[model samples]
Target chain A: MDISAFVLFWAAIFTSNILLTNFLGMCSYLSVSREVESSFGLGVAVVFVLTITAALNWLVYHYILVYFGIVYLQFIVFIIVIAAFVQLLELIIERYTPALYYTLGIFLPLITVNCAIFGVSLFLVIRNYNFLQSIAFGAGSGIGWLLAILMLAAIRRKLKEKMVPLGLQGVGISLIITGIMALAFVGFSGIVQIQ
Target chain B: MFTIIIKDVTVLSAIGSLLAIIMVIAQRRLSNYGDCKIDINGKRELVIKGGNSLLSSLSDKQIFLPSACGGRGSCAACKCKVISGGGPILPTEKPLLTKAELAAGDIRLACQVKVKSDIKIEIPAGIFNIRRFNATVTEIIDYTYDTKGITFKFADGEKIDFLAGQYVQLETKPYGKVKQGVIRAYSISSKPEINSSLQLIIRYVPEGICTTWVHQHLKLGDTVSLTGPYGDFFLRDTDADIIYVAGGSGKAPIKSMLEHLAVIGCKRKMTYFFGARTTKDLYLTDEMHAFEKVFPSFEYVPVLSHSEQGDGWTGKTGFVMPYFKDAIRDPKNTEAYLCGSPGMINAVTKALIEEGIPKDKIYYDSFG
Candidate 1:
């Protein structure tokens, strides 16, 4: 019996949410999720970069790493693929859609180091996902990260006006909220098995 | 082990070569730019390759415009009016342009606008004169605990002709732990008569990118790049009694103008009021006093805001502006030259205006 693409996709998004459950990309999530508007912008940017890089990394891994039998070099290969893809994407975006590029600004460079992108690629390869399954899982993981950040950003904006305790004013309170959200997401773990 | 290593290297090199070849082919076949021409202010025309942005295109032809961010489009400093041959205005340019700017023909960020076709752009006349200079650090002298006076001698150019208070941009190359070169603006501290070299009075701003490079990384003998003579702060040509007020590193341009007056033998009556928090902040008292002797009508007034215990300060007390208000016999006829932090400039300007000096007669260069 084989796990279907749809099952893996939903499982990766909810039960094994990369941000809340595993906490893979907490740095940018916390820093950029301060404002709802900026968070939405960053979220969309992450989704776009993650989906494209995942597919590109898959191609590189299968064609280059596997062909050379240097599977140990997967990490380096994935990083280089992600960086080059981001640079090419930046040039294309500047030429075709200048507006989106401006809004991304310095954040575009930040996307290259984003952990969620590498996480998605690594998981797809480890799970031996077929091309269709990899695409579905990659896009689903990005959507999951997007949804989690949007919720966190809205909560953070509301908490700005409210009295926050001295010790938990910034990242401390955000981490606590993330822990609670992870437990809530655990409710969906029984619905599907990812690995 | 050597065999495995050789195989790994061979594979990597093969992949690199393949990518390079593909890139070259794509660049040549896919990215070919056709003939393009650019018209400047309905006065001149330039013909060049068509694909690159207007900023780099203009720069290639030696038409320099002020772009502090190096055509990254992040600064929005390189804006030009594209009256014709400009395609749709880009979204990147919208944030920098006002509604009035957009309505008046076509205004575009030069870095963002591609030269897909021949274009006409309206550029300021002053931008035509902006030039890059190769200079060497001739001298570096400490003025205060945190301030240093740096002088750069032009390698080839005999003189840099500039207004008394205008600033020049210094390009600091990446050294030691730094990564990339960056451009930072500083007011020219040297008198205009000595045109072969440029001097700047820099105050250390802790952890500031450009200042840190200048203070820690720059050496006395190394060469550096500079472009300049920007800004509109200068002494107005008038016979009225002059009031010059400055603080901290803001002393640069004011010192230049005062030295300029002595060099030109101008006999206008001038009172220079220098404000400092303490005695340690005061510098060049003897030099200023010498200027007063040279020009019999000039006076140097150093005001201390917070006097020390054993400093034995015997000068005007309190802020510099209030002292000017009490001492000036006729405020209405005085032309003021001010350079300082934005807060100090605002306070002094407000006080001078209240004292019957016309706003037009008062010129200021503020570092915000």
Candidate 2:
């Protein structure tokens, strides 16, 4: 249970990666990963939302759910906390970061229901991660998802010019590419043992 | 066990309420964009609270922009020149703007642009004249099985000055199962001389919010709210030969133009072609015939595309394009006015272009 922050960070990205290994948040990973610019924007938004929601949910879980011994209600409680936190972050970003607001603004709403953020919070609670470990896990998982999507997007952009087969053009080819990337990511499994 | 359930409910509710209160406070503090000053054409300045869209802001100032989708950004009709301080064009606006317009850095969709700061925008001078009026439904005439010609008299003894072919937005109150009021643009079917009274011909669209309300729930002697005289679809002041093509409720603005011509006693040669699916689908035939009788220069031709033998229809049959191709003899000196669904208008516009009518000479209003 005494997981180091350094090991948790690397393990979340590589060994137990949120997208490539765990296969969570594949919907946006497949759809938004078609273009590099849009993929970049969505990746940054996911990372930002995931890290903050993870820390916020950790506090909520300990101070409220665990304090009252209502740990069974963590799922619904965590979701509500994540959604409200994302909304607040959106309003603040829209006010301050006008540049990033234009690029990543539209995808802010999409990040609320992103199962990857929920997965991070749930995993942090289940694994009994301390505050630092939870934050590291959250940021690492988000960066892992971002990296996977960016790689796939770059390959897809290249694949656009090359002639794909008749049957495997759009989503068919993209899914195949993702599968191959997932297999490649399995090579990083034993680098850092999370459990 | 029962006491444990109560405690669980109490704790969850407490957490939920705490989050809700926090959200309320954050929304109030963060979403407030403060009061913004909008410079209109370098002549007028409007200072208003600025958390909403530029379209709604302009509307609050009584400067109405023509938006068929009512600021939903689907219509793209509420576009204006954002001269400065409007910030970058949004992703919602990119698809609606042309490459040239985007590069020019002046045009933007008013509905998508938030007024977060002081901005300078240029709108058409005519938008200032649009005024909201309270009116009472004096009569509703069934023009077809699905269409009604509803006439509204100004609740105040005020006359509206408008062009021959323009539209007004009719605001519907919530009725029946519907809970929200909506505004729909309907063309004025009568000429400007009608003055204190305005008539709109509306076709019932299946399950449409405003149309269903108008057809099923609206009663005569009921008071309604309306805003005036929007659109560029109108008769040009020229002596050129006129060719008018219309179908269904598209006949509204065209009828207004023809009546205005008749009232002015203009002697230009005019050919009016009205298309319908069958004889039963046609209305105002007697009135059009009467206009032809009084104005020797005008001719009325009703075309039915789906007429049956029992109907005994003796008129040009098939789509209006063929009849238009045959009737348009002097395309060089002819101006064609078209109002219809997008399909019909596109066909007619194509035919007009093929027949040598200048693109600028072809005026049309196509309902999406």
Candidate 3:
């Protein structure tokens, strides 16, 4: 609770990265990260949805759930909030910015079920971070997810040229690369510890 | 504990209501695309509500466009010339449209093209002639063990005027094991002269949703819905000798053509080659033979690829192509119309070409 927003942000990006460290959103992370262009588009959409939903869920958790002594309902309430937020955002974005909406494609609505999105809000609550700290963690985790997927997309594009084993092709090679990247991310534990 | 449960419900419902209110408000204010006008072929204009896809909007206005995937953009059958106001071509539409189509800047998948503003589009003039009809199942004759000639009479005594060899989409209501309604295209076997009634010869396909429903669940006097007169597989105007090759249910369109020829008393030299696996697999032999009697120049040759033992004498034994190859002496002087499976069409086309027929003179409609 005494951690500064700056430290929390960096820690979330490095040591406590949502995708690489916790493997929270592996489905879209693996599927959409095959293309750099689509991964970037999906990353930006996730970042936007995550940051906004985190701030909103934090307010709901504290001002309403805690005040009403129904703190145990946070999980269900958080999911509902996230789903509604994503749907509403999709409608608004589709109406206003048609280009951006199409670029996100099916992935925009898919963010509602993405575990990393729900994970961010839950982490903010479990850590009992203040409002500013929660926002920083949310934004940082989103950036962390974006960075990991972009790196994977670049690697996968390059892997297309390499003579991969027939049995170790496609998602098989991708999972191995992700594991190696996860190991590299584990090295950041020495720089900063969130706990 | 009861009080805690009540509090939880109250708080969650309150939050849910608030979000619902926000969503309703945003949807209303954001999705109101206002009145949009569509100019069709620079001749007809339609003023309608905005925000629906061009395909559904046109279909809603009784302007039917052929779509096989039902607007999922998978089939790519609903491409139309969009003169303006279609916005940018989407990535989903990019793979389906050709480079020429994209370069023309006019073609777009009508199902994917959103009617965001006033737009102009061009459609085939033939699409305007298509109409939906409700008909009652008057009769169902088993053509073979697996094939049936089901006849439907127009409910309101309405007549559908179509070319001889065109097809229609038959719609089957969800029944028994079929969970949802299905629409499947079948060539119209009935003659254009039979205005108030239409017949289709459908071969039962294993696990086919519509076919299974038609074969097993459909009953006489049951009302069926069908939409009409699609396809461009008909006899061309020519004085040349006609060569007809058909197998299985592919005989439908050819039958329609022959019926038209019989009705008009066509004098052109015509050779009809029909193929089957055995005696039971063949249908309409007597009917086709009757046509040959009516028109002396018309010849019916039934070929069996696998003639069984104890089967009575057959006219020709082998695939239709081999028999057709040997019988037709001057392929150059003939116009060939083929309808059947893709394999049969390809084999017969190759055979015809080998027999000195021009490839361009061979017209075919190959089904999967």
The TM-score of the first chain in every model comes to 0.92, 0.93, 0.95
Comparing 1 and 2 on DockQ, the stronger one: 2
Reference-based lDDT, residue B148, model 3:
97
Docking class of 3: medium
After the best TM-score superposition of candidate 2, give how far the Cα of residue A112 lies from its true spot, in angstroms. 3.5
Candidate 2, B278-314: lDDT as tens digits? 9998999999988887776888899998999988898
Q: Rank the candidates by lDDT, best first.
A: 2, 3, 1
TM-score of predicted structure 1, chain A: 0.92
lDDT of 3 by residue, A43-98 (tens): 88888888898899999999998999888989999998998899988887777666
The residue-by-residue lDDT of candidate 3 on B121-209, one tens digit each, is 99889988988889999999999999999999998878898998888888879887668787778999999999999999999999998
lDDT of 1 by residue, B1-368 (tens): 99989988787667656655655565565455588999999898999898788988998887877676777767666788888877777656777788998887487889888887789889988877777889999899988888889999999775688878888888888877778888777899889889899899998899777888888877798799888777768877878889999988888998899888777778778889988899999998899889978996888999888988889898888888777765566777889989989999999999999998889888988775
Q: Candidate 2 docking: what grade?
A: medium
Q: Which candidate ranks first by DockQ, i.e. highest?
A: 3
TM-score of chain A of 3: 0.95
Q: RMSD (Cα, Å) of candidate 3?
A: 3.1
Docking class of 1: acceptable
